[model samples]
Target: MSSGRIQQALLAWYGDNARDLPWRRSRDPYRVWLSEVMLQQTRVETVLPYYERWLERLPTVAALAAADEETVLRLWQGLGYYRRARNLHRAARAIVEERGGRWPASAAEWRQLPGVGRYTAGAIASITRGEPAAVVDGNVKRVLARLFLIDEPVDDAATLRRLWLLAESLVPAAAPGDFNQALMELGARICRPRRPRCDLCPLRPDCRGRRAGVAESLPRRRRRRPIPHRQEVAALVVRGGRYLLGRRPPGLLGGLWEFPGGPVAEGESPPQALARALVERLGIEVDVGPRLAAVDHAYSHLKVTVALYRCRLTGGELRPAYHTAARWLRRRQLGDLPLPRVTRKLARHLAA
Candidate 1:
């Protein structure tokens, strides 16, 4: 199949069918960069409000650079995996300091900026500078592998590297940004992960997967190892009607409240782990009780089997080195706290 013909088809398809996302409003590098960063591991619907609110709060590189971390974090609260926000803040400072507060104009120069990965650099360069750089993100990988019927499992490292080369090869010099966006849009909207609408695909006729009658089967994936189950005992330490909560340490779900818990080490029981965690973290020794309930909470990278315990503190002092703050809040007020989903799950189980 001719690359030019495929490009024409994709471009036409994009014009008619692309999602009307706010960030696609223009080729502004800063807005594009911000949207790309915010969208990582987040759904488009989820990112929309955060992006709008964030842009309204910090309209320029200088604004973000000058903003304090706490305000930044507060704005980014509930977004999850807050390191992206922090890195965005850090990179903004560097741009304002070294690059005269403008987004670096070249892909190589953009790559030099903090938090900017290869795919992000490709997006920034293509969108802003019209550079012929291809972005081999998940969407692109799915689209290309099916279009060409590439049999390499997309999850394999070598196969992914091969896909990158193929992505670059197929990226036409003319309107690289639109081309890249078109492929991504097609994959997202039409060549979906499951139950794809192949009949609606512009590349349907040219798609090798379709030609070979394997449209649903191509772009094979290496089976992902099931997320390991981690067992932990959470202290639902109740003094009167109030429960103990600790702020998660900075970096990765930072600043959120959690009923303290960690993995149940080999051969150690949940009650024992809870007892140890309380003393180690808060200088408190507690009497472990029967399990209040167990919860299965799943996050992006792992699944946790959490055992909740009703316990009383026998003796100890509140320590704050590992936590930003520790507090005993009434059960009703626990809902007001910005706790992790797992912590809220614990409360729900306890209430039931």
Candidate 2:
């Protein structure tokens, strides 16, 4: 029940039960930091291959800093949340060029880097530098909420602050990193959000929510409003067996390649939308053809059903207005470019 007892139980459980992940094999700050960044808003299963591939490609901060944006985005193509990849690239440059390649040793110092929030900074600092920093990610918040029988919505500003303080208090002076990771591991594997295996949990004896018969319902989140849905269209304009791709400008889904298209206005058909988008964005006239595929994709704030259509460029030269660059890429060259997931879906359809 005491903080010392909790820490002891957690660290022991972690020592025995932790997964043999590649990043866990070393205390090297770069490896630790890179793993943490890649794992943000992503599952370990999803991140595993990407993590391995990333390390193989750009193993060091200097390597990442030296890599071009296209290369960085290519490695991170399917991982989504492209902003994370961009920020990681920027942070690497900052570390190499500005910080003289020295990794930040504390959570506060790590926070100064791009995309390194409090939770990420804490994980990096504690794991690699042995700083007594608390990490309050979704997993940690869930564990803490159930352990303490917290009834307030965990997403509430006040509730979040309290949870952070509680996590800070439980961090051990020795092996604080192990303690933080243990708590997260417990939440991830045992004290899960749904159907938590409380019997297997290290904190079962001390979990107040389990005792109160409400562990499943603790760590409540505020009701999320319905995400807006948009109907999008893309044109598959191929010439001489080469497909056209456009590079997005530096913003949402930035620095990534895509089949040029735009959102469908209220009553416009997919074909009409595709034609208008091509004219406005690329300054080329196109005759929209049959629909090739329709893919549904969701982002944090929006859901889109993208309809891919085969089209032929009819009139005018290819002059891109919204995109930074436009090119007709050969089939073999597609693998080297970084494309959005929806675009990849369309590409696969074309290949099929």
Candidate 3:
């Protein structure tokens, strides 16, 4: 079958089975852009609430542009990969300042905006402006790779170029947005990464990988290195019902708040590390006490084991050195401030 026939089949399936998501209900570029950003590296269910709340708070591009960075970051607290939030804010400001609140008309123009890559620009332009731009996110990549039975490493530059070309060819002129979305939906719900329900797929008739009985393995993946693990320490410094929290420097989990601490250096005990971190990060000395909790958290490439120690300030004034800011907040007030997941868990432990 030709690509045109496959596009029609997918569109028919989409019209009948497309998810009634909030973003799908509107053609507003701002809403579409917001949903796309929030959905990056995050599950739909996890992003739903954040998307709703963000739209409610920053209803328009102008509002988002006017909002402060801290407020935006706080709204995006639990949604990891904070760089997305920062870029969204930057893009909003650019739109407001550069275009006087008018969104870019085409995918190419959208790509010129901050953090608006090819996939994102295509999504926004097609979904909102009816442009015939193709999006090749992970879901779309998997779908096309299997449908065409491509076996090259999905991350290879040549493979990516070939997939993008395939996606562009499959995008129909009419309702290109729906065609693109349908492709993604089919991949997400039917042609899943594992245990794909080929029986329910609209494109099953044309799937080369299905005929070869290798649909699940068509998109070859590169081997990943083992994630390195590190030990760290945090000081649970409290005084008069307030706990001390410090803002991270402008890197990694930048602009977020967390308990003051640092890595457990070589040959150093947790308590010793906590004491050292307190002096180095906060410009104060603390006498480390008993262990409060040992929390394990994993990032995309790093696994950390943080030993939380109860500590008392023993010398020097509380001053911010390495951190952006430092504050002592009561238990109830901590909820209002943005905190990392581990810090929130520690807060709950303290409250209990």
Candidate 4:
């Protein structure tokens, strides 16, 4: 079957089965851009409430550009990948200042923005600007890999390049956005990683993987390296009904507030690590007390276990050494500040 016929079948299926997501209801570029950014490495169910709440708070590109960094980060608290929020904020400002309040008219132009990569740019352009651009996200990759029966590792650069070429060829000129979205929707709903619903797939007739009896196994991926684990300690310093929190320096979870702490050295106990961290980081001596709680969290490359310890300030003046800033915040006020997921969990444990 020709690409055109496949497109027709897919589009027809899509018109009947596409999920009515909030972003799909409008062609507004800002909303589409926001959704694209949020949807990266995140699930629809997880993003729904965050999307609704984000739009409510920052209704427009202008609003997002004008909002303070802390405010934006606070709104994006649980969305992991803090860099995405920062880049989105920067891109909004650039769109307003450099483009005179108008979104870029083409995918190429959108790619020049801070966080807009090829896939994101293509999605925004095709979906909102009626541009015939190809978007190959994870869903589309799975769908295409199975459709063509490509067995190369999907993460390989050459394999991905070939996939992109095929995607570009298959995207219909008319209603390109709908066509691209249809491909993604099909993958998300029918061409899923496990137990794909090949019977319900419109492209099943032409699917090479299905005919070859390997639809579920095409697009093989390389094994990931074992994630390294580390143990860390945090000092829960309470003074005058307020808990002390320190701002992380500019990097990974940058600018987020958390309890003062650092990784435990080899053979160092949690309490000793906390006590030493206080002396070196805050220039204060603390008598580390009983362990409060232990929280386990994982990042893309690292797994960490954080042990929270109640502490008393034994002596010395408080001074910020490693942190950008340090503050004593009430439990209620902690909600307004940006916090990493593990820190938030620690806060809840303390509150309970």
Candidate 5:
């Protein structure tokens, strides 16, 4: 079968077996946009609950546009890669103010929206508008690389460009949304990253890699270098019953709450790092004690091993330098506060 026949077979298979994801219930641009943002670097199972809650809170783009940053951040508490939340908020506001509260229709127009990259624009445009744009996310990348026997790693810009061209060529006409979703579904379920279900795939007969018995090796990845590691000391400052938590400022994991902490310099003890960080961020003297809970958080770029300390706030009022504001809340009130999962995981130990 030709590549076009392969796509047609896959599309037919998808029409019968495509997952009934919550995001597919409606073609509303806002709902689809929200799911796409939340689903980036996140699993569908995890994004589902968050998506439902987010929609319940800010059902409309204008509502999200009008909501306070704190409320938005709180709603986005456990979802990491927080720039997605900020970008969504910024995009919502942009649509409200500039586009008269309606999202743009074309991929070119959607690309101008905050945080909407080419892939995201393509996803939104194709899903919502039936545009002939294909999205080459990780799943689709695996599917394409394995299907066409491409040896280039997905992360290489040149390889990715070629993959996109191939994707554009294969995307079926008239139902780009279904086709893109089917490709992604195939990748997520049958064409998995670790183990593919070639026996069950409709395109198995036509797959070049499968014919060569190299399906697993076609999308060869460069050997992964160990993720760079950094250590940090966090001061878990508590006053009365409440503990001090800072709202991370906009940029990366912006808007999420975190314990006061930063990079631990060379030869610096955890206590020393804790004290220096408190002074720099809050202008307060804190007595760092024994370790409370240590967590290793992995980001796309690097990894951080954080050692948290229970600190006594000796002096100085709140003068948050790198955060929007600081707050102290009871252990139970912590539930109401949206916090980083790593920080929230630490809270149980701190509350002990």
Candidate 6:
């Protein structure tokens, strides 16, 4: 099939059916970049509120750059994959300080920013700058896989490279941004992962997968290993109506506040593990009491069930061995600090 014909059909469909997203109304690089980052591994409905809240608080790149880390993390409290928010802050600072607040002009230059990969760079460049760059996001990949009936796993590096090349070849010089968005929109709305609405798809006639009666299963992936489950514990050490919270050191869930504790070892009971973890992680002794809450949370790579137990700080110096800082705050005051979902669940249990 000719690239021109396919592009024409997709663009026409997009013009009629594109969702009225906030970012689509403007060609501003900052807005485009922010939307692309937030939309990664997140659905549009889920990102809508967060995206609006972010702009309302930190409207400009310069504003975000000037904001403190705590404020940024606080704004991004419930949005997981906090690394994206941190990288956005870093990239904003770099753009303001190093580039004199000028946005990158081309996809190549945009790739230099922190947290920006090929897909993001291509999106921002093509959408805002009218550059003929191609984006191969999950949506685009699905569309492409079905359009050409690609049998290979989309996650493979070799397959990804081929998809990129195919995208590059098809992206039209005229309104490349609309073309890219149209292709992605097609996958999202019509060529869905399951039970696609092929009857309404503009590319229905040309879709090789549909012709071969396998459109829904064209974008196959390799079998993934089972997600490991972990058991952990947290100490709710309360004194004078105040609870102890620890600021995590730089790493996974870094800079976020949590009830002090760690993973439960294989042979250790929950209370014993909590006591040992407090001594090892916080350099303080706690008399583990009755359980307060059990938080079952799942991250991308692992699932964890954290048992929260009431504890009394018994002895030892109040030194932060693993945390950057430790503070005591009332249950109500917990709202002031950024917390992971698991920590928030524990706090809610306390409040209840």
Cα-based lDDT for every prediction: 0.84, 0.91, 0.89, 0.92, 0.84, 0.92
For candidate 3, lDDT tens digit of each residue in 86-185?
8999999999998888889899999998778999999989999889999999998899889999999899999999999999988988898998899889
Candidate 6 C-alpha error for residue 200, in Å: 0.7
lDDT (Cα, tens digit) per residue for candidate 5, span 41-130: 889988988899999999999899999877887888777777788888888988999878877979999999878888888999999999
Compose the digit string of candidate 6's lDDT tens values, residues 1-352: 9998999998989889999999999998999999999988889988999999999999999999999999999988888888888999999999999999998989999999988999999999999999999999999899999999998999999999999999999999999999999988888889999999999999988999999999998799989999999999999898898989999987789899999999988988999999998998889987888998898999888999999999988899888989989999987889999999889877788764
Q: How would you encode candidate 1's per-residue C-alpha lDDT over 1-352 as one tens digit per residue?
A: 8888899999998888888899999777778999988877677889999999988999887899999876677677777777787888989999889778766878888888777889889988998889999898888888888888888798899988898898888888989999988988888889998889998988887888878877777678888778887888888888887888888787647777788766789999788888888887777889998788888988777888998888888998888656677999888887666666777778887662
Clashing pairs in 6: none
Residue pairs clashing in model 1 are none
lDDT of 6: 0.92
Task: Please estimate how well model 5 matches the true structure, expressed as its whole-model Cα lDDT.
Answer: 0.84
Q: How do the residues 76-144 of candidate 4 rate in per-residue lDDT, one tens digit apiece?
A: 888878889999999999989988898898999999998889999999999998899999999989999
Compared with the true structure, the alpha-carbon lDDT of candidate 4 equals 0.92
List candidate 5 segments past 4 Å from native.
none
Per-residue lDDT tens digits for candidate 2, residues 1-352, read 7998898889999999999989999999899988998899999999999999999999989999999999999999989889999999999999999999988868999999999999999999999988999999999999999999999999999999999999999998899888888888888999888999998988888989999999999789999999999999999998998999999988778889999999999988889999999988899999998898999988889999999999988997898899888999987888889988777777888773
Please identify model 1 stretches exceeding 4 Å from their true place.
Answer: 68-79, 97-100, 238-243, 250-252, 289-293, 321-338, 349-352
- The total of clashing pairs for model 4 equals 0
Over 4 Å off, model 6: none
lDDT-superior candidate, 1 or 5 = 5
Model 3 pairs whose backbones collide: none
Per-prediction TM-score: 0.87, 0.96, 0.96, 0.96, 0.94, 0.97
Stretches of candidate 2 above 4 Å error?
none
